[model samples]
Target: MFVDIHCHLDAVKNASEKIALAEKENVSLIVSNSVDIKSMEKNISLSKRFPIVKVALGIHPSEALSMNEKEIEKAFSFMEKNLKKAIAVGETGLDFKHAVTEKRRELQRELFKRHISLALEFNKPVIVHSRNARKECINILSEMNAEKVLLHWFLGSKKLLFEAIENDWLYSIGPSVFENPAVQKFALLSPLKNMALETDSPVLFNGKPAEPQWIPRIAKKIAKLKKTPLKKVETVTTNNAFRLLGLQQKG
Candidate 1:
C-alpha cells in the first residue's frame, strides 16, 4: 500500500474520480489538507464519502495573510471543534516567498506557531508548507520541540535538511524529484525511513496536474536515487507515512 501524505482533495475538480483512480493504483491512504474553513468542511465530507480519504485541517499561510482577526479566530474555533475528524493539522507554515515584507513574514510566523500549538494540544501530526522560509520554520519547530512533523515539498539547504533529519522530522517527497535536482538530492541524502511520498494533487507540475496515483512514479524515482529495490522503497515509505500519521498500516 502507498500513502500520499499531503494533497488538496478539496481543491481538486472531480475529486471522487481522482480518489477512485488512486485506489486502483494501490494508493491506500490520502491525507487531504485544507487551506481554509470551507475546504476543511469539504474535506470532512469527502472523508465520509471515500473510505480511503482522511483530512488535515489548517489554514494555508497565504490564505491566513488576508484574513482578519475575527476570521482567523473563527477558523481556529472550527478546527478545534472538528479536530477529531482530522488526521493532522496542516497545509500550515511560513511562505516568505509570497510574504515578502518583514511584517507579513512575522504575521505568518505567528500564525505558524499557533497552528503548531494547536497540533501539539491535540497531539496531531503537522503537515507543513515552508516555501522560502524553511530555516525559520525549522527554528520555530525546534524552539517548540515539536515532534510528529512532516515537511512537505521541502527544498531547504543541505545543512537545514540534515538538521531536520537529525531531529527525526519526516519530509514528503513529491513528483518534483523527477525534474528538480535539489529534490532528487534530498531523496538521495535523506534516509528512506524518514521520508514519505506526496503529490500535492491538483497542483500543476510541469504544466500537468498531479494526482495521488502518481505516488508509484515518485517512489520509483526515490528507489532509483537510493539504488534500492522498489519494493523496499515502497514498504519503507508507506510505513513511514502510516507511522507519522498515527494510522495503523493496512495492506
Candidate 2:
C-alpha cells in the first residue's frame, strides 16, 4: 500500500473516478489540501464520504495574495471553526516567485504565520507550500517552533534543505520526481523515514494530468533513485505519512 500525503482532490476532473483508480493501486491515504474555504468545505464532505480522504485546511499564497483583507479573514475564520477533524494545517506558506505585490507579501506573511500558529496550537503537522521564500519561511517556522512540519514539493536550495533535515522536517515527493532532476535528487537526499508521497493531481505528469493512482509509479521512481526495494519505499513513505498527519491508526 502507498499513501499520497498531498493532493488537490477537488481540482481533479473526476474525483470519484480518480479515487477508484488509486484504490486499485492500494493508495490508501489521500491527504486532500485546500486552497480556500470552498475547497476546504468540499474536502470536508469528501472525508465524511470516503474513507481514504483526509483533509488539511489552509490558504495558498497565490490565492492569499489576490484575496482582500475581508475575504482572507472570513476564510480563516471558517477554517478555524471547521478545523476539528482536520488531519493537518497545510498547503500553506510563502511563495516569493508568485505575482504578489509588496503589500500583499506582508499580508501573506502574516496570514501564513496564522497558519503556523494554528498548527502549533492544535498540535497538528503543517504541510507547507514554500518556493523561493525558503529562507523567510524557514526563519519564521523556526522562530515559531512548529511541532511537526511537512514541506510539500520543496524547491529550496540544498543548504535550506539541510536546515530542514536538521529540524527533522518531512518532505513529500510529488509525481514530478520522474521528469524533474531536482525532484529526483531530493528523493535521493531525503531519508525514506522522512519522506511521504503525493501526486499533486491536476498537474501534468509527462503529457497527462496526474492522479492519486500515480503514487505507486512515483514511489517506484523514488525506489529507483534511492536504489531500494519498491516495497520498502512504499512501507517507509506510508509510515512517514501516518506519522506526519498524526493518524496513528496504521494501515
Candidate 3:
C-alpha cells in the first residue's frame, strides 16, 4: 500500500470521489495539510469522515503574510486545541517567494518557529514548505534541533540538500517529478530510506490538479531514477511515511 504524506484534501474538487479513487489505487493513507483556520477545520472533519484521511494543522507562509497578529494567534490557538488530531504540524515554513519585505520574512520565520515548537511539544513530525527560502528554513529547523522533519516538495541547492540529508530529514517527492528534471534529480540524489511520496493534491501539474492516485506513478518515477525495483520503492517510501508521521500501518 502507498501513503500520500502531504496533500490538501479540503481544497480538492469532488474530494470524496478523489479519495475513493486513491483508495482504489492502493493509497492507504493521505496526510492532508491545512493552509488556514478554515482548512484546518475542514481537514479535521474530513479525517473523521474518512479513515484514510489524516491532518497536519498549521498556517502557510503565504497565508501568514496576509494575516494580522490577532488572526495568527487565533490559528495558533486552534491548532493547540486540536493538535491531538493532527499526525504532523505543517504546511508551515518560509516562503520568501511571497514574503517580499524583510518584515514579512521575519513574520514568516517567527510563525514557522512557533509551529516547530508546537510540533516538538507534541512530539509530531513537521512537514515543511520551504520555497525560495530553503537556507533560512533549514537554518531555523537546525537551530530548533528538530528530529522529525519532512521537507515537502523540496527544491534546494545541492549543498543544502546534502546538509538536509546529513541531518537525516525525509523529502517528499510529488507528481511533478515526472515533468521536472530538477525534481527527478532530487529523487535520484536522495536515498530511498530518506524519501516519501506526496501528491500535494489540488496543485496543478501539467494543467491538471494532482490527486493522491498519482502516488504510485510518482513512486514508479523514483524507482526508474534510482534504478530500484518498483516494489522496493513502494515499500520503502510507504514505510518512510508511516515512520516519520507516526502512523500505524495496516496489516
Candidate 4:
C-alpha cells in the first residue's frame, strides 16, 4: 500500500470521499498535515474519526506573523494533551519570499525554532516548508538537531540539499518535479531510500489541479527518471514514510 507522507486532506471538504478513492486504489494510508492550531485540531479530529488517516500538526511559515508565545504555548499544551493522536510536527519553516519585513523574518525564525523544539520534545518527524530561505532553514534545523525532517516540495539550493543528505534527512518530492529543474535534479541524485513523495493536494499544478492519487504518478515519474523499477521505488518510499512516522506498514 502506498502512503502519502504529507497531504492537507482534512482541509478538503470532501476529504472522506477522496480517502475512499485512495482505499479503492490500495493507498490505504495518508498523513494529514495541518498549517496552524485550528487546522491542527481539525486534522486530529479527522484522524480520530478515520483510522486510515493520521496527522501532523504545526504552524506554517506564511502564518508565522500571527503566532506568539501564548499561541505557541497553547499549541504545545494541546499537542501534549493529544500526543498519542498525532504523528508529526510541521508544515513549518521559513518563507522569506512571503515575509517582507525584518520583524516578520524574526518572528518566522522564532516560530521555526519553537516548532523544531516541539518536534524534538515530542519525538516526532517535522514537515518543513522552506521557500527562498534554504540556507537559513538548513542552519536552523541543523543547529536544533532535527533528526526526522521532511523537506516538503523543496526548491532550494544545491548546497542545502547536500546538507540535508549529509544530515540523513528525508526530502519529499511533489508534482513540481515534472516541470521544475531543481526538483528533477534531487530525484536524479537522491536514491529511493532517501526520497519520499507527496502531493500537497488541492494545490494547483501547471494551472491545473492536483490530488492525492497524483502521488503514485509522481512516484512513477521518479522511477522512470531514476531508471528504477516501480515496485522498488514504491517499496522504499513507503518504507521511509512508515519508518519516519513510527507507523507499522499495514496491508
Candidate 5:
C-alpha cells in the first residue's frame, strides 16, 4: 500500500475519478489537505465517500496572507471544533516566496505561529508548506518545540534539510523529484527513515496535473536514489506516514 501524504484533492476538477484511479492502482491512502473552510467541507465529504481519504484542515499561507483578523480567528476556531474529524493540523507554515510583502509576510508568520500553537495544543502533526522561508519556518517550529512536523513539497538548502532531519522532522517529496535538482538531492541523500512521498495532486507534472497513482514511480525513484529496494522504500515510507498521522489499521 502507498500513501500520498499531501494533496489538494478539492482543487482537482475530477477528484472523484482520481480517487477511483488511486484505489485501482493500490494507492491505499491519501491525506487530502484544505486551503480554506469550503475546501475543508469538501475534504470531509471526500473522506466519508472514499474510505481511503483522510484529511488535514488548515488555511494555506497564500490564503492567510489576505485574511483579516476576524477571518483568521474564525478559521482557527472552526479547526479547534472540528479537529477530531481530521488527522493533522496543517497545510500551514510561512511562504515568503509567494506572499511578497513584508507586512503580508509578517502576517503569514503570525498566522503560522498560531497554527503551530494550535497543533501543540491539539497534539497533532502539522503538514507544512514552506517555500522561500524554510529557515524561518524551521526556526519557529524549533522554538515552539513542535514534536510532529512534516514539510510537504520541501525545497530549500541542503543545510536546512539536514537541520530538519537532525531535528527528526519528516519531509514529503513528489514527482518533482525527477525534475528539480533540489528535490532530487534531498531525496537522494536524506535518510529514507525520515522521508515520505506525496503527489500534491492538481499540481502540474509535465503540464498536466498529477494524481496519487503516480506515487509508486516516485517511490521507485527515491529507492533507486538511496540504493535501496522498492519494498524498503514502501515499508519505510508507509510506516512513517501511519506513524506521523497516528493511524491504526483494523482487521
Candidate 6:
C-alpha cells in the first residue's frame, strides 16, 4: 500500500475526492497535518469521516509565532482534550524565511520547542515544518531527545540530511523530485530506509500544484535515481512510511 506521509487535506476543496482517488490508486493511507487550531479540527474531522486518514495536530511555523500566550494555551488545552483523536503533533517548526520580525521568529522557535516537548511527552511522532532554519531545527530536535521526527518536504543541506540519516530520523520527499536538482540529489544519495514519499498537495511545484496520486510518480523518480527497480522502491518506501506512522503492515 502507498502512503503519502505528509499532506494538508484541509486546504483542498475536493479533499474527499482526492482521498477516494488515493484509495483507487491503492494508496491505503494518508497522514494529514494542520497549520493551526482551526485546521487541526478540520483535519481531525476529515480523519473521522475517512478511516484511512490519520491526523497530525499542531500549528504551522508561519502561524506559530503570531500566537499569543492565551492562544497557545488554548491550543495546548485543546490538544490535551483531544489527544486520543490525533496520531501526532506537528507541521510545527521554525521558519526564518518568511516571518518579518525577529521577535516573531523567536516566538516561533519557542513554540517549536514547546511542540517538541509535547510530542516527547505524548510519545507521538512530530512532522517538522523546517524551511530555511534546518540547523536550528535539527539542534532543537537533538537537544529535546525527540524520537519519531519526520521532516516534511525536507530541503536541507547534504550535511543535515546526513545528520538525519545518522540519527535515523525520517524524511518525506514530495513531487519536487521531478524538477528540483537538489531534491533529486538528496534522493539519489539517501538510502531507501531513511526516506518516504509524500506530496504536500495544494503546494505548487514546478509551476503546478501537486496531488496525492503523484506519490507513485515520486516513487518512480526515486527508483530511477537509486538505480533500483520501481517495485522495490515502492515496497521499501511503503514499509518505511508504515513504520514511521505506526501502522501495521498488511498480510
List per-prediction Cα lDDT, in the order shown. Answer: 0.91, 0.86, 0.92, 0.82, 0.88, 0.86
lDDT tens digits, residue span 1-251, model 4: 67778889866758888888777766767888887779888888888788888898888888756777798778767766775568888788999999989989988898889889888988998889888887888899998888899988876567777788788788888889888877888788876767788888768888765677777788889988999888888889888888888888654
Worst 10 residues of 3 by lDDT: 242-251
TM-score of each: 0.97, 0.95, 0.98, 0.92, 0.96, 0.95
Q: What does candidate 3's lDDT look like per residue over 56-116, in tens digits?
A: 9999999998899999999999999999878999999999999999999999999999999
Worst 10 residues of 1 by lDDT: 242-251
Displacement of the residue 178 alpha carbon in candidate 2, Å: 0.8
Q: Cα deviation in Å at residue 158, candidate 1?
A: 2.2
CA displacement after TM-score superposition, residue 12 of candidate 1 (Å): 0.8
| Cα-based lDDT at residue 163, candidate 3 | 83
146: Cα error in model 5, Å: 0.2
lDDT of 6 at 170: 91
**Tens-digit lDDT track for model 5 on 131-225?**
88888999999999998999998876778888888888899999999788878887887788888899999899899999988999999998888
Candidate 5 local lDDT, residue 102: 89
RMSD of model 1 against the true structure: 1.0
- State the lDDT of candidate 2 residue by residue for 169-200, as single tens digits: 88888878888998787788877877888888
TM-score of 6: 0.95
Candidate 1 lDDT by residue in tens digits, 123-157: 99998999988888999999998999999998777
Better of 4 and 6 by lDDT: 6
Clashing pairs in 4: none
Query: Model 5 segments beyond 4 Å from truth?
Result: none
TM-score of 5: 0.96
Model 2 ranges with Cα > 4 A deviation = none
**Runs in model 3 lying further than 4 Å from the true structure:** none
C-alpha lDDT of residue 249 in model 1: 71
